[model samples]
Target: MTVSNTRQQVKLSDAVQRIQPSGIRRFFDLASTMDNVISLGVGEPDFATPWNVREASIASLERGITSYTANAGLMELRSEISSYLKTNFGTSYSPENEVLVTVGASEGIDLALRATVNPGDEILIVEPCFVSYAPLVSLVGGVPIPVPTSIKNDFKVLSEEIEKRITNKTKGIMLSYPSNPTGAIMVKQELEEISKVIIEHDLLVISDEIYGELSYDSVHVSIPSIEGMWERTILISGFSKSYAMTGWRLGYVAGPEIYTKAMLKIHQYAMMCASTMAQYAAIEALKNGKEEMENMKVSYRQRRNYFVKALKDIGLNCHMPGGAFYAFPSITITGLTSEEFAEKLLLEEHVAVVPGNVFGSGGEGHIRCSYATSLPHLEEAIKRMDRFIKRTNG
Candidate 1:
C-alpha cells in the first residue's frame, strides 16, 4: 500500500464544522460516569409511558404491524393528531394536508428548517431557547438570530424587540414555549403582539409547543390559531413531554398545505416515517390519554413548586416556571460563572445541572435544574446544592 496522507485532506462542510457539541450533554456524560450523582439536567419527564399507551404499542407489534408507514405517516395517527389539536388547542388542520409524523419534534424542527431555509437565511430564535434550534438552522445553511429575553420580564420577548431584528434575510421565527431550560411561556396577549410582528414582516413562524399540555396556571396559546397567522405558521408538537413518551420518539408538525408538503417531502427522504409502534401509541395518547397527561402535569407542578422553594431557601434567585419541569435560577450571587457553578456542584456535591449559557447568551448568569426527577431525588439534590453553596461561600 502506498503511504497516503489523503485521510487528513478530507474536506468537511462549514455547517458541520461550525456546530458545537451541546453544553447540556457534557454534564449528562459526566453524571453518567459518576457514582451517586443526582441529575437535574435531563429534560425528559420521569414518568413511564402510560400503561394504555404502552399496551397500544404492544398490540401493534403482536398484530405484526411492523412495516414502515407512509412517508407522511400513518393516516390514522395524523387524523388523531388533527382532531387532538382542534379539540385541545383550538387549532384546526386537515390531517391529509397539514400533518407529518416525525421521529420526534427534533426531527420536525430539522425538517422544517431544511425544507424552508436557503443559504444565509435568518431564523429568529428566542433565548434562552432549546439547544437544538441553532445547530439545526446551521445544518440547513441558515443563520440563527437569537433575541434575548430577560428574567425580569418573565422571559417573554417584547414585540418591539422582535420587530427590531427583522431584515431582508429573515425567513422564519422559531418559538418554543414552556421553553426548555427557562420554562418561560407567553400568554395569549404576548403571542398576539408577536403575531402582529410576524404579520407585518410577513415572516413564517415555527411554533414548538411540545410543552403545551404541561402548563400550570394557564392553557397554552398557539400563534397559528390566530387568524392570518395559520397560513404562515408551522405548529410542532409531540407526545414526548406531555404524555411521558420521550423514549417513544414520536412527534408531528401541522401547517398549511404548501409548507407541510415540502416538509413532508424532506421527511420522506430523510426519516421515511416515525416508529411504527410508537405512532400507534401516540394515536392512543392523543385520543384517550388526556387524564393520564393531566395527572402527570399535576405531579410535575407539585415538583416544580417544591424545587423552586428549595432553591430560594438556598439563596438562589429562582423564578416560578409557568410550564415545563425546569427551574432556571440565577447563580451570579455565588460569584460563579454558570459553567463553574455547574462543574463545582457536580464534582463536589454529586448534583448535576445544565449551565444557562448552554441555551444561549441570555442564559449566562443562570443554571437549569429539571424537576422531572422523583420528589426524593429533588429534595436530596437541593440539600446537596445548599451544602455546596455554603461550603463554597464560607
Candidate 2:
C-alpha cells in the first residue's frame, strides 16, 4: 500500500551549480583533439623546469627524504620564499608564522577567500583576470563583483572605479597584476591611487602576484609594499610561472598573522601540506635559479614583442602588454563576437585562442592569445590568425 514509484533529481550545492565551467579550459580541450594545432590559448610557460631544481627533487628522492613536512610547509622553503619576496619585491613576512604553502596559487586564492569571505560578503575582482578568481569567491559564499578595467587604462583598475563600487558588503578586493588574459600591470603610482580608496574603505586585498617576476616594462610592485597596505594584503605567489614549476603544484600565501593563521587552518584541514620534494625544488629555485629564470623571461619578452607586433601588423589593435605572456587584441575588426572569432579561427586556421568575453565585462570584442609558447609557434599561430582575420573581414 506504501510504495509509489518516484525518482527525485539529486541537487548539487548552489555554489557548484551556479558557476560556469572555465572558458579557458573549453578551448584547451578542443585544441587537444586536433593535430598540428598551434594553440595560443593556454597560459603556461613552454620552458622545462630548471635542471637544478629537478636535480634537487631527484637528490631528495634518492636520499629517501620523502616524509611530509610541517603543515605550514617546510620551514626552509618558507624562509626561501620570505627572502625571495623581500629581495625581489620589497615585501617582508615572518617565515615562521606568516607564510603558508599550498598546492598552488590557485589554492592560495581559495584559502584566502574561504578564510575571509562570509555569506553574502562582496569581493571586488579586477578584470579581465584569471578564470579562477570569481568562481572561487562564489564558491566561498562571497558575491564576486567585477571591477572591469578597459584597454584605455592598459587594463589597470582605477581608484575612482573601485571607490564607486565599494559598499559595506565588500570585504576584500582581489588583484592579479601582470594580469592574466590582458597582461596589464599597475605601476607604483597607479597602485598608490587604488590603495587610497582601499584604505579609506578599510577593505582587505588578495594580491595574486604569480607573474610578478615577468614584468617586461617596469619593476613589479608588490601591493603590500605600498604604505598602509601590508596590514591588509594577502600576497599570493608561486614557483610555477617564474621558475617553470607548474606541474609541481606549489605556491604560497603571506600576510598578517590573523589572516595567515585563518588560511593556515583551512590549509591544515584541506591540503595538509604541499609536496615535500617540490618544497626542496622550490628552495633550489629560490637559492640558485635566478639566471635561468631571467633567461626564460627574456625569451617571453621576445615572444611578446613579436606576437603583439604581428597582431598589430595584421590590422588588429592591441595595447602592448606590460607583463605576462598574453596579448588581448580587439577582434571587432572582423565583425565577429569573441566566441565566434575563436571558434571560426580554430575551425578554419587550426589556431586556438581563448575568447575574451569569458574573462568578464569589458572583455568582449577581444581575444586573449598567450605568447608562452616558443617563438616559432607564436610566429606560426600569428600567420594562421592573420589568414583567418583577413579571410573573415575580406
Candidate 3:
C-alpha cells in the first residue's frame, strides 16, 4: 500500500492537552536516571510489601489467577475493605453496592470525577494538593477552583475557605487528609467544621484518605463518618501507601449506592476491572496488614522528627508535618523558585526533592521532601541539603 504524502497528523483531545504533565515526575525522571542520587521526591513507602501480602499475590499467580474480576471488583475484597473502614472510622459501607475497587486511588479520583462532573461545573480543590486533582477535573470538563490553606494554620482545610469558594456552579470538593506535599491532616473538629460547610452548601466530597493510617499525632477521622456527609461523600483510599503495595495497584472508592453505581459505570467502561491478583492481595492486606502498617508508621514518625529538626537547624522554615511521609519546607530563604531550588539541589548535592509549586498555586516558595526513605538516606539527604543551603545562601 502506498503511504500518504505525509503521515496522518493525529488530532489530540484539547481537553487532554489543556492540562500540564505532572510536576513530580519531572524531578523523578532526572533523579531516577542518575547515579549517586538520594531522592525524597516520590511519595511512596520504602518498605517492601509485607511478606503475607506478597505471598497472597504469589499464591494467586501460582494458581494462574490472571483473569479479570467483576467490573465492580471482587466481592470478597470489597467486603473486607468495608469492614476495615467501619472498624477504623465507624463509617459503614455496603460491600456489594457502595464499594468499587479501582486500579489505585488515582483511578478512583478519575472515576469519581467522570461520574459526577459536567462541563462548567466547579470542583473545590484544596491547594498544595496532589498534582492530579486539577488536571483530572479539567479532563472531565469541570473547572478546578483551588482553596488555599496557609502554613500558619498548619494547612488544614478550613470550612470558611471552603465556604468562600462555594458558588452555585460548585458541584463538589476534593480533600486529602494526611495531605500530599504538606503532610497536614485535619483533626476531627476541623473536619466537623468543614462538614458543616459541606452540609450547608449541599455539596459532594471526594475524600482521598490514602495516608489516613500514617497520622502521627492522632487517629484519622473520615469526613463521611461525621453526620450529614455520608450520602454525599465519595471516599477514595487504597493499599499503595498503607501496605507498601504500590506495585499491586489496588484501591477502592466507597460512596452511596447511587454515586457508586455511576462510578461503576465509568470504571466498567474505562478500566473494566482492577488487577485480579492485586485485588486478592488487597483482601489479605485488609485482613492481616494493620500490624505491618503500624510498624512502618513508627519508623516514619522517627524519621519525621529527625528530619524536621534537621531542616530547622539548616535555616529552612519547615512546619511539623502531622501525617504522610512528606515534609514541605519553604525555600524562600534560599532565594530560589521551587523548581530552581529542586534542580540546583539535585545538581549540587545529588539530593532530589519535589518542588512545591507543582502541587498548586499556594505551593510556591516551598519544596516537598518525602521522608519515606530509610533513616540513613534521610540523614544523608539532610546533610546534603544543609551543605547546599549554606553554600547557596552564603
Candidate 4:
C-alpha cells in the first residue's frame, strides 16, 4: 500500500522560481562550447592583475596571513580605499563605520537591497541596466520598476522619466553608470539633475560605480558625493574592473552609518568577510595600481572607438559609449530580435555578443559588444560581425 509507483515533483520557492535566469549567461554558455570564438559578451578586463598587486597577495601568503579578516575588512585596506575615493572622486568615507567589504560588488548589491527593501516596496531601476538589478530587487520582495532610457539621449536615465514613475510605494532607486550594456555615463550635470529628483522624492539610492575608473570621457561622479545626496545614496565599487582583480572577489559598500551597520550585520552572518589575501592585494592596488589602471583604460578607449566605428561602417547604428568597455549597437536594421541576432551572429561568424534586451526593455533592438579585449581581437570580431550583418540584411 505504501509503494504506490508515483513520482512527485519537487517545488522551488515561488520567490526564487518566478525570477528568470540571466539572459547574459545563455550566450556566454553558448560561446564557451564553441571553438575559435571571440567573445564580446562578458564585461571583463583582459589585463592581468598588475604585478605589484599580485606580489602583495603572494607576500601576504608567504607571511602566513591566511586567517579570516575582521568582518569590516582590514583597517589599512579600508583606509586606502577611503583615500582612493577622496583623491579620485572627492568623496569621503570613514573606514571605521561607513565601509563594509564584501565578496564582490554583487554581494554589496544584495546586502544593500536586503538592508532597505520591505515587501511590496518599489525600487526604480534604469534600463539598459546590469542584468542582476531587477532579479535582486525581486528577490528582496520589492517590485523592480524600469525607467527606460534611449540611445538618442546617449542612454542616460532622464530625471523626468524617473520623476514620472515615482509613486507613494516607491522606496528606492538603483543606478549604474559607466552602465553595463550601453557603457553610457551621465556627466556631472546629468547626475546632478537626477539627484534633484532623488532628493525631491526622498528616495534611497544604490549607486553602482564598479566601473568608475574606466570612464573614457568626463570623470565618473558618485551620486553620494553630490550635495544633499550623501544621506541617501549607497555607493558600490570594487577591485574587479579597476585593477583587473576579477577572480579575487573583492568589493565594498560605503554609505550612511546606519545603512552600513545594517548591511554589515547581514554580511557578517552570511559572508563573514571578504578574502584576506584579496584584501591585502587591494591595499596594494589602491596604493600603487593607478598607472596600471590607466593603461587598461587607455586600451579600452581605443578599442571602443575602433569597434563603434566599425559597427557604423557595417551599417549598424552604434552610440559611442562614454565609459565602461561596452558599445550598445542597434540591431533593428536587420529586423531581428536581440536574441536572434546574438545567437545567429555566434553561429555564423564565431563572434559573441550579449543580446541587449537582457539588460532591460530599452535594449530590445540592440546588442552589447565589450571592448575589454585586445584591439586586434576587437578588429577581427568586427570583421566577422560585418559579414554576418550583410548576410542577414540580404
Task: Show where candidate 2 strays beyond 4 Å.
Answer: 1-9
TM-score (all chains, Cα) for each model: 0.98, 0.97, 0.98, 0.97
lDDT of 3: 0.92
- In terms of lDDT, model 4 sits at 0.91
Off by over 4 Å in 3: 1-7
Residue pairs clashing in model 1 are none
Question: What is the number of backbone collisions in each predicted candidate, taken in the order shown?
Answer: 0, 0, 0, 0
Model 2 lDDT per residue over 1-394, tens place: 7986788889899879999999888888988899889988877898999999999999999999999899999999999999989998998999999999999999998999999999999999998888888899989889999998998878989998899899879898999998998999999999999999999999999999999999998999999999999999999999899999999999999999999999999898887889999999999999999999999999999888888989999999999999988999999889999999999999889999999989997799999998999888888888898888888888
Q: Give each model's whole-structure lDDT.
A: 0.90, 0.92, 0.92, 0.91
Q: Please give, for residues 1-394, the per-residue lDDT of candidate 3 as tens digits.
A: 9877987888999998788888888888998788999989878899999999889989999999899899999999999989999999899999989999999999999999999999999999999999999999999899999999989888888888998889999999999998998999998888888898898888989999999989999888998998888999999999999899987788889999999999999889888999998888898988988899999999999999999999999999999999999999999999999999999999989999999899998999999999999889988998999999989999
Off by over 4 Å in 4: 1-11
lDDT of 2: 0.92
Q: After superposition, how far is residue 355 of candidate 1 from its true place, in Å?
A: 0.4
Worst 10 residues of 1 by lDDT: 1-10
Candidate 3: lDDT of 98? 96
